[model samples]
Target: MVDHVYDPPERCVAGSVGPPGQRTFFVQATDGARRTTVSLEKEQVRLLGTSLVQLIDEVAPREGSEEAAAAYLDNAPLDAPFDDDFRVQRLSIAWQPERERVVIEAYDRPDIEDLMGLDPEGDYPWDGLPPQSLAIVLDAPRARAFASRCTASLEGGRPGCPFCGQPLDPSGHICPRANGYRR
Candidate 1:
């Protein structure tokens, strides 16, 4: 008997938005094996300044190995092109070997407001916001450190997502995935 390793399709290509007030978009990569969706804010999309396909090729986790994938995500720094105006406020990476899926989330922080906006009571309006969060699914090692830090920052002292400046509930949000889906 032989055990075979399977690689899931790369979902959510990376790219950036064009100028301020521009809408940025990326495609979810599908290879008939898996389907994923990468969501980012208009500012983050602008910060990427590259094609989603190119970004996925550059950041997708390794097949059958979570450790390698986590390392890839941890070391995969935000592109320098938009580093001046954008920073990775929060990041969540999850790898499901059994399902051959990896979910990488990066909340873009364009500034202090973006950071504070994560708080539901931070004095910002979030009625029409498109969930300024990004999630990438693939097969790889779980990036626990990033997720832990993101959660701690959001729920530790202040209450918010820390990355996108959105309000958060220590008890969790209606989305259930609040606190990075920590239970």
Candidate 2:
């Protein structure tokens, strides 16, 4: 008999929430499919950034799907609210199956404006450096399942000693305690 193991779900490819007061937004996942919609308070729209129209033009998907979600991220035209002198230096993607969420972490650098061609040697007038981190959550079950399968494959392939329940390497272990007890 073939034993079917429980697999988690996939991670979300993309998602977003409006600023304050707006209802929460979500990109729900279904059978490897994704759906996007505006489901949040009106006040939340302000948090999207200063150029709402540009942001929507770049990120808001006319059609909902994983591909569309990825496109949104690739073309996201995020603008700095405080100043026009900033750029994303690094970006990281993480999926949490237990929480049913996908997180995008971004780290901004001081010379971002110069790198993005906005300005050369432009002084960022903000009180302090822009935050180094940002997170966006999306719903993706298939991603979670994939992650689970990968993790299982790695754990199942580990070599261990049957008698002692200890992991074994090609180089055998010398157990002094076992030898002393035997003596």
Candidate 3:
């Protein structure tokens, strides 16, 4: 139940530091003074970015607020020594009218105790570290820009196989859409 909240974070984006075929996905949020970067599934990044844009467009209370959002948060290189709170297992999005921003919550997967229904250790707390979550808030324009950046990041990776729309590594691709033929 512990959450790291970044209200109107200075920056929030989905980016990768490795090559396309061997890249690791990440979602990073910073508040100028503090920065938090977390690992996430590539699909998760894609969905979050796209969903934020859609939600803001559909539900923002103010008219033309989407266009007024300031995409000022620049994606600097992720700080080194990625911490424990960096891995994200679940992501949720919502519009906060009071803040005039879209809030994105990234949560860790359920712990063994929660999944197994019993804590054999008898000392493990369900609200332990690995199960924590990070929440970031961004305005409509920033959310839109973030979605575009995330989508661009995904596209920057390996080229997709024309046959199946699956990513193609630099060396080659075995496209199942082509019936297991290398495309």
Candidate 4:
């Protein structure tokens, strides 16, 4: 497995492209010379942001954390002219107490059918090809900033239906609460 480790990336953030209801989400990590970008589901971005904020609050509760986050807030769009290294299969985050950092890992996906068809007693799955991954570590303040950007990006998307909580497309969606009515 190739692990692109950015021990303390110069910048890391979540961003999206395209319009709401058809947007493609991505997470990017960059040092100076190398930048790694990976595409992921919108839900993954949401959960990561939520988890980052929750984890930071749990470990580094301090006055002015929000204010401190502003200092590191990166509202800049993702670096352009870049191709995604891979599509994220799984995302995991954790706190590093000793170093006082948050570690985020995005694992590249393997074929679902191959994974499901694995033979426990046969040769290991993935055969000769190992998936690549991206790992990023950030300080608490930067993590908070990253989380804020995530929340902002999500809120800019399509408005949610009051009754069903599903995103309302540009043409409206069939809300379950509305009994099949497109609203």
Candidate 5:
């Protein structure tokens, strides 16, 4: 369940802790008085950011229209440090037309054990841990900025192979498109 909900985030940005591809991705939300940072998968970061841009483009606003939410974030350092309790496993995004905001929810990934496709709920003792979640709301401007930042961050990593479009490591990449030939 989501315990924290920032209805209107003063700052909401997707950032990383270390170098590209080697760093952990995080989305930080701040409401002036409180702040929270949640870790996420790199793929999730890319998809979420891309989707946000698409959403904003679909509802393109005029130069001085009132539909825009004007919640622009500076993409500064996160107010709160990353914590284990905020590890995100699942993400949900939605558009609030009335408020002209984009709502994003990050949920902690659940743990489950399966024995040969059998459920382990009754066989094992409970761990007494619950999945925590955070929900952040962003305006159009802020959402656009965040999406751009995320896309740029993802692109800053190692270049991809032209043959297979797979990321090439420092050594090189063996592209399957060329029958396992190094590209």
Candidate 6:
């Protein structure tokens, strides 16, 4: 499988398409004129952003990190021509102490049907081949900015149910905490 590596991409951000409750999330990485976008679940984006922040704090905690994140924040929307190259199935993140860079890898599984028969170990049975992946490496500031932007994008979604914390749809949701009553 091809690994599209963007070491220090010109721009990398997590964004969503469509309205709040019905949004589709994606991670886009751009290097010069080349761009790659991968579709993923909302929870995946949230977890990645949260994990990145935690990892940075653990590896390079400093007061200036927040200031630098704000200074380099990318509030702009995802780059246009928003086409998804693949659907991400798994994600991995790491902090490289030697380079002081954060690396994020997103593995793609084109379709759910492709994994209809998986082994007990959750390994695919496809000729021992690995999934296509997209990797992005970012400096401390850029990494923080990416996490901040991810948080902002997530908050832009539909408000959560006050009782259950689940997303409240336009017609309201039957919050379990509210005893199945629509709220």
Q: Choose 1 or 2, whichever is better by TM-score.
A: 1
- C-alpha local distance difference test of each model: 0.38, 0.34, 0.72, 0.84, 0.72, 0.84
Model 3 clashing residue pairs (backbone) = 38-86, 39-86
Candidate 1 wrong stretches, greater than 4 Å? 1-11, 17-89, 106-121, 127-134, 140-183
Candidate 5, residue 83: CA error in Å?
3.6
Q: Candidate 4 vs candidate 6: which has greater lDDT?
A: 6
- Model 6 regions more than 4 Å off: 110-130
Give the TM-scores of the predictions, in the order they appear: 0.27, 0.25, 0.78, 0.86, 0.77, 0.85
Off by over 4 Å in 2: 1-140, 175-183
* Candidate 1 lDDT (Cα, 0 to 1): 0.38
Candidate 5 — number of clashing residue pairs? Answer: 0
Candidate 6 lDDT tens digits, 41-160 = 999989998999999898877732888778778888999877888788878899888988898988865355656675647755443666688999988888989998888778777888
Clashes of 1: 25
**In model 3, what lDDT does residue 72 have?**
51
lDDT of 6: 0.84
- Model 3 weakest lDDT span, ten residues long: 63-72
Candidate 3 per-residue lDDT, tens place, 14-130, comes to 777677787787777778778777888788888987787678778763542544544354556656655535577667888877877787888776444455856556664344644
lDDT of 1 by residue, 1-183 (tens): 101111333322344334323423332333455433344444444333223223333455233233544453332322323322223454444434466555555554344554664765664443444335444454333332222222222222335554555545555444334545532
For each candidate in turn, give its C-alpha RMSD to the true structure in angstroms.
16.7, 20.6, 4.0, 3.6, 4.3, 4.1
TM-score, predicted candidate 2 vs. hidden true structure: 0.25
Residue 58, model 6: lDDT of 88
Best by TM-score: 4
Model 4 per-residue lDDT at 126: 40
- Clashes within 3 Å, all models in order: 25, 18, 2, 0, 0, 0
